[model samples]
Target: MKVTNVHTRRIHQPKEKVSKLFKTLATTNDLIWPYENWPAIKFLEGLNVGSKGGHGSIRYTIIEFNEDDYIKFQFSRPEGFMGTHEFKIEALNENQTEIRHEINIQTTFETSLLWIFVIRWLHDALIEDAFNKVENYFTEAKKKATYNFWVKLLREIYKRKPLQTKIA
Candidate 1:
């Protein structure tokens, strides 16, 4: 099955400032990923091409990285996820910017079932939470994204399992 997914948000801040926050992705000082509410993205060799890491049971390797533009990761785990997912910073204006997360992949039957039944809902919630984290950074009033019923149920079920904390 071929899948194409995208999530984007416009921030009322300059691209430069938003890009600075993106630079902290997967880092100790990460300012974008909603690690407090979800699994944190980790890279053994940091944010550069060839670095390997991922959140939860999914895994990937960085295929491209541009400090002020975007970072793309090619999936290598959760068998049958063939392709890439990336986060891009687009300047909409001198004082506004858009943060986009896109996924393009072809999944095998098993993975397709997983994606449709579980991953899709979880992925949507995760991305929205990440966007909220970014938007929360530049405003006095913070934004929070709520998970849907399916997402809440999925999270509850997944919480019963032990989480992986280190990347190998």
Candidate 2:
């Protein structure tokens, strides 16, 4: 397995908003790349759902999803190998949330020499870029959402806050 690129971003949004964003990413395929319905099953041709499509569900077949605080997935291509991607969310403050994305690639290359070469070349070049793109997408989305939320909040506060009292 090789560790590619990892990106972390802090979004200035409430915990609830952050959770909603995460949930949107987790449950909605429209927000993700290679856009396709039933992505998990479509990508993993012969896989079966180990449990119901909810928290702690184990995907035994080609693709799998498990929701334990964070939503994680494991997928395998035609090659006899698999990769795992996980997203974690942490509440930083009343108006900030932290998101971390981790990706691991495991291939069937048996020889250490081949593994090292692939890790150094393919991983650094292709896999890292792919993960970075995904991270950038989420980061941009979160930023936009956070900005909108704060703007609206400020507007509401400005409209509601009483005018400053004049000193005698």
Candidate 3:
């Protein structure tokens, strides 16, 4: 099965400021990834081309990196995931920028089932929460992403028997 997923958020901030957030990714000062509530993204050699890391059961290597513009990661774990995911920053205007997270991959039959029943719900919620975190950082008003019933339930289950969030 071919899966293509994209999530984006527009922030009312300068492109430079928005772009700076990319540098903090997977770091102690990360302000984008909703790591406080979910699994934190970590890399063995930090954020750079060839650095390997991922959150939860997902593992990937940084295939490309551009400090203030883009980052792409190619998946290597979770069995049947085959392809890449990337984050892009686009300037819409002098003071507005968009952050986009895109995933493109082909999945095996078994992984398709996992994606349809479990990972899809969790992944969507996770991205939304991450976007909310990014948006909240620049605005006085906070943004929050709510989870659907399935995501809430699945998160509870995982908390009991946590997946291998660390890459080997």
Computed on alpha carbons, the lDDT of every model, listed in order, comes to: 0.93, 0.42, 0.91
Task: Mark the regions of model 3 whose C-alpha exceeds 4 Å error after superposition.
Answer: none
Question: Stretches of candidate 2 above 4 Å error?
Answer: 26-68, 78-80, 109-168
What is the C-alpha RMSD, rounded to one decimal, of candidate 3? 0.8
Candidate 1 per-residue lDDT, tens place, 30-60, comes to 9999999898899999998999999988899
Top-scoring candidate (lDDT):
1
Instruction: Indicate the TM-score of model 2.
Output: 0.43
- Candidates ranked by lDDT: 1, 3, 2
Give the range of the ten consecutive residues with the poorest summed lDDT in model 3. 139-148
Q: Worst lDDT window (10 residues) for model 2?
A: 51-60
Write the residue-wise lDDT of candidate 3 on 1-168 in tens digits.
999999998999998998887788999999888898999999999997999899998999999998889999999988899999999999999999999999999999999999999998999999999889888988889888777789999999999999887676
lDDT comparing candidate 3 with the true structure = 0.91
TM-score to native of every candidate shown: 0.97, 0.43, 0.98
Displacement of residue 144 (Cα, Å) in model 3 is: 1.1
